[model samples]
Target: MSLDAPYIARAAKPGQFVQIRCNDSFEPLLRRPFSIHRVKGEGSRVKDIEILYEVVGKGTEILAGKKEGDFIDVLGPLGNGFILPRTTNHERRTTNSEPRAIIIAGGIGAAPLVYLAEELTKKKIKTIILIGAKTKNLILCEKDFKKATPEVYISTDDGTYGSQGFVSKLFHKILKTTESKFETIVYVCGPHGMLKCIVDICQERKFECHASLEEKMACGIGVCLGCAVKTKSGIKLACKDGPVFNASELIW
Candidate 1:
């Protein structure tokens, strides 16, 4: 048996995420947000969508142990806009040139990055991915991302695999060393602290940045109002409004 959700695939976008209720009952009550990793099949007949997750606590631990056929309740394709450059309706400008993008993932954050990378490739945008984990085993989908982007960098805090440092450290180094201004957009997903640090760096360096946030969510939709983040505009629900937001807009 395989887990299935037909509606989600139709609605998902890069940088958006879903909230999944893993248990049969409401003991856990809240749904957990996971980045839409990738779409597995084609068209209206999509077989499944992949979601990358880490076993951090009760919710994710249960999800991690699920068998292939297991069914889980999920709500999503939630969030605000993705990082795609806005095209104005007034301007009928079209260009063959592809936009360049950089994706940074920390630990399980790589889950969403994988899906976003695939989407960027389909749009013919150039992509680069940098992922970090404690060790090589924790690094997910290195080969898959390599297929989507010409450049892929992996870093492990323990030096057991790729570069030996935090993922942000590698990102700063790349920003400093790269001669070509090939990077126009930056997307990041990770722990709150990590995300905050990256957002700060982007702000200081004047880079366009979007970040996926993690929070305790009671309802996957807007009904619960449990997962709220303070933004420049006001409070926004992470489930309905975003698991993703412009780095500058967040109060973090």
Candidate 2:
């Protein structure tokens, strides 16, 4: 849902996230983590920032009760964000045949990709999003993503939505059939099993890939050392060092 956090909207970037306090009381004391789903407005005068989530726990249940005028405590836009291509000169970028992106998300992982897509589209870089979910109702963000780019593909565990299978199958099909025409990089976030499969495909084909990981974060800053992941460079905190890391860097 959208929040009128102008400060967060102004400072947020793709792949970065926020930590929210669900209630004023101390019962569910620690805050919960969320990705910045969308950021709006212009320059430093940002108007809104959005977050996508599910109510599977106590914190979320409390959050669902928030009213229109209610004030919620949020700490963000936190963590290192996606490292978007920095080249400002599109002519040069296109001339160099800079790689296009393929964004893969499963279930709620789609949240961050929408924001990432907005950044890529503004840069005029092509992006194709692949989304997969257990059912149609669980699928998220297709409409918003389509507005950023016309290329979107979806799959479902049941045949209730787009294709009746896993999203990785769609990726495999593209690799087996039409991938030679473009230079590609993959950006993915999903269940651990799902991500491993996707990363394996990219690794075998030698495609550069990045992944956004979610961890139980405490003290959203680094001091807590709660969100560590084993990376090729060594152990790093998902909160301070990343929620995003190169696929190659992860131990998997």
Candidate 3:
């Protein structure tokens, strides 16, 4: 079954995300959050939107098994994503040169990173991608990311492919080896534990970072209020206020 859902895409940003309900049944009571993936066209009418998700549990498995014609319910263009610093945003206002962007993905986290990379590339912004998985087979969208960024790095825990170490390790190594004194921004999407670790690293290194979070969701539009997360500011809904937030804003 072909899946199609029409949505307004006016608010989508590179790191923003959405929530989806794969089935009407309540067996899986919560909605699933997926990165905006990609938003096409402009204005009130969005030509297309894409989301890449891995089948992990009941909800996602149901989504994965869906045929081409199936229609899944989605509530979206939600959350605050990575906003380039005004200075940097202004510098790249007219030209794309000198905006250095780096993306890191773990497993299915590659989904949003791919979309983010694509957008950056369209703006003529230079990007680098670092993707990690336990093995090569688990690495998602290798070709897509490579196409978006001139430099792409791969790391596997088992040494089955690419660099044989943690993705974070490879990221640090790259930072060390590169001589380019450019302002760099980071966007990451992945498991909570992995994100926490990355956040720690970013804090220690003083790197500007943005992260897309995942949690149990229900309504996806904030009505359920099930995806609340504790932030430095206060309690906020992950499904509405975020699935994406600045690393500094998080209490982690």
Candidate 4:
């Protein structure tokens, strides 16, 4: 998933994504969108970019077969990224005033949060990643998350992982019972059902939350309107206006 795309790496931001075509063939004409998994560099120079993916169908199966040194087609650093917290002028030397950002992901949806957490941690913002799956083997990105923050929590619907229920439940517990000196801000990305549940919980508690959405995107750019998602404001293109949006903006 790593590519030597310095241009993209330098411009890449947390929650920003790339669209990649599997091959030169016209069979699968459209490019697939993937979150920027990680970025590597120093100062303003970037060396590489990576993406996390799962093979769910034919297109992904083709993507999985890519070999090393293979020439791939990609379009990237697209869409708006997460808005990171900033330190106050008087306390600029200290990053303690930043909110404790909670990142929630389900199944393969964990793809985007890695870079998000990386960006947040770089700003000295406290982050806790909550990952959920149907089973232990289904859980993704725990080790990677650990590399970004030690506060990674997990759960599985079948009780085969760290917790024995939905990750949303665990988040509710943390929001209600856990004691933290900093404020809380929740970020989520997952299936519709899962998002509905989490948003419901956030609404009930009046917690601030943001969500990243995935939809069928034929054109990575704004044209075609293939991936329009209904939001509270109106119809917005997931590939253009978002992929990331406030929880209040989402209708569901």
Tell me the alpha-carbon RMSD of every candidate.
3.0, 2.1, 3.3, 2.7
What is candidate 1's lDDT per residue for 94-133, written digit by digit as tens? Answer: 3432346789988878777787888788777777798888
Q: Ten residues in a row with the worst lDDT in model 1? A: 89-98
Where's the lowest-lDDT run of ten residues in candidate 3? 1-10
TM-score on alpha carbons, each prediction: 0.87, 0.94, 0.86, 0.93
Error of 2 at 42 (Å): 2.8
Best by lDDT: 2
- lDDT of all predictions, in order shown? 0.78, 0.87, 0.76, 0.84
* lDDT by residue for model 2 (1-252), tens: 789998889888999999999988997999999999999877777879988988989999998888887899999989898877544445333444566789999998898989999999998887888899989999999899899999888899896999888889988875676556556778898888889989989999888788899999888988889899999999999998899988888997
Error of 3 at 242 (Å): 1.4
Question: How well does candidate 3 score on lDDT at residue 86?
Answer: 28
Clashing pairs in 4: none
Per-residue CA lDDT of candidate 3, range 118-193, in tens?
8788777777899989898998888988888769999998999999988889888988887555566788888777
What would the TM-score be for candidate 1 when compared with the true structure? Answer: 0.87
Q: Which regions of candidate 3 are displaced past 4 Å?
A: 1-3, 9-11, 40-46, 85-97
What clash count goes with each model?
1, 0, 6, 0
